[model samples]
Target: MIKLQNVEKVYRTSSIETLALNNINLDVKKKEFISIMGPSGCGKSTLLNIMGLLDAPSKGQIEIDGSKVENYNDKDLAHLRNQKLGFIFQSFHLINDLSVIDNVEIPLLYRSSTAKQRRDLAQEALEKVGLSNRMKHFPKQLSGGQKQRVAIARAIVGKPEIILADEPTGNLDSVMGNEILGILQKLNEDGATIVMVTHDDAMAKKTHRLVRLFDGTQVM
Candidate 1:
């Protein structure tokens, strides 16, 4: 469902040029679970951003669900992202002021769905993550695991085809991290393509395949 060919990402300022990714070639099939493992500065997050269309590569081509996205217009890219991709971040990224249900509904607000439809979809998503009981709670009112579950619910609420998760368990304790991983595994079993960037070797081993990176290049 995703493809990258000879991708290169470079950040350039007046006096500095840093290569974030170099000659990267990757392909993720539909419904597959893939993990990216690398040390700091190895571009795992950069690759995830590129895959999610949050960032563009300096060179090379990206194709998502058979559509070339390297040069897609902003509106087109946003629409594509909304319709095909979901994101989970280490920080949870939930709105502190909104209830969990509202946070999950935020993405749907951009679509043409009615308020009722959004609520239904959001509720279903929360149920999938086992967070239905916490729907009315704010971010600060929930435990770290619960907050991450809410974030996962928010990501999947739109029924996107792929999920890009960056350091999903980075901030959690081992127990909570394992709980989060279990939720991700269940989501993958339900056929959501997941590409996760993680520094934990044990976590990487749990995925179907691992892509190792170093010095901004895929080494395995």
Candidate 2:
């Protein structure tokens, strides 16, 4: 469902040029769950951002569900990302002020939907993450696991075709990390294509395939 060809990313400043990715060529199939593993500064997140269309590669081509993303302007890119991609991060990027359900509803607000529809979808998403009872709770009131579950709910609220999770369980304890992996496995079984970036070997092994990286190169 996604393809990257000869992808290379470079960050340039007046005095330095850092290569974040080098010649990355990957093809992600429909409904497949893939994990990317690498040490710190290995460009895993950069690869993910490029895959999700959040950041463009300095050189190469990206094809999402067969459509080549080439020279698209900001508005066009935003629309595509909203329609096709969902993101999760290591840190729950929840608004401390918004209730859990309200946080999930944020994605739907950008779409043409009634408040009731948004509420119902948010409720259902929380249910999937086993957070239905905590709908009214704020971020500060939840445990770290609960907060990450909230982040997952927010990501899936839109039911995007692909889920790009950047270290979704990074902040949790071993037990909590395993729990989160179980949830992700369930989602994949239910037909969501997922690409997760993780530093944990056990976590990476649970996915369908593991892609290893070194420095900025795909080594395995």
Candidate 3:
């Protein structure tokens, strides 16, 4: 469902050129669960961002589903990203002011939908994450696990083809982290393509395949 060919990411300043990724060639098939594992500064997150269209690689081609997207303009890329990708980050990026349901409804705001429709969809998403009863709760009122569950609900509410998670369980305790992994496993079983970047070996092993990186290169 996704392909990256000879991808390279280089961050340039006036006097420094830091290469984050080098010659990354990856293909994620539909419904596959893939984990990206690497140490700090190993470019795992950079590769995930490039795949999700959040950041463009400095060189190479990207194919989503089947179309080449390397040349797509900002608006085009934005549209494609909205249509095909969902993101879950280490930190729950929920608005502290918005209620749980409201936070989950943020993605649907970009689409043409009625308030009722958004509410229903958001509610259903919360139910999937076992947060239906907390719909009215604010971020500040929830525990770490509950907050991550809220983040997961927000990511899946759009039903995107691919879920890109960057250290999704990084902030949780072992028990909570395992619970989150179980949720992700269920999503993958239900046909969502997941590409997660994690440092935990046990977590990485739970995914279908592991792609390890070192010094901006694929080492395993």
In order of appearance, the predictions have TM-scores of: 0.99, 0.98, 0.98
Model 3 lDDT per residue over 1-220, tens place: 9999999999999999999999999999999999999889989889999999989999999999897996799999988888888999999899999999999999999989999999999998898889999999999999999999999999999889899999999999999999999999998998999999998999998899999999999988
List CA RMSD, all candidates. Answer: 0.7, 0.7, 0.7
TM-score result, candidate 3: 0.98
Give each model's whole-structure lDDT: 0.95, 0.94, 0.93
Off by over 4 Å in 1: none
The order of the candidates by lDDT, greatest first, is 1, 2, 3
Query: What does candidate 1's lDDT look like per residue over 5-74, in tens digits?
Result: 9999999999999999999999999999999998999999999999999999999999999999866899
- At residue 14, what lDDT does model 1 achieve? 100
Residue 187 shift from truth in candidate 1, angstroms: 0.8
Q: In candidate 1, where is summed lDDT lowest over 10 consecutive residues?
A: 196-205
Give the per-residue lDDT digits (tens) of candidate 2, residues 1-220: 9999999999999999999999999999999999999899999999999999999999999999888988788888888888888899999899998999999999898889999999999999999999999999999999999999999999999998899999999999999999899999999999999999998999998899999989889999
Worst 10 residues of 2 by lDDT: 70-79
Model 3, total clashes: 0
The global Cα lDDT (0 to 1) of model 3 is: 0.93
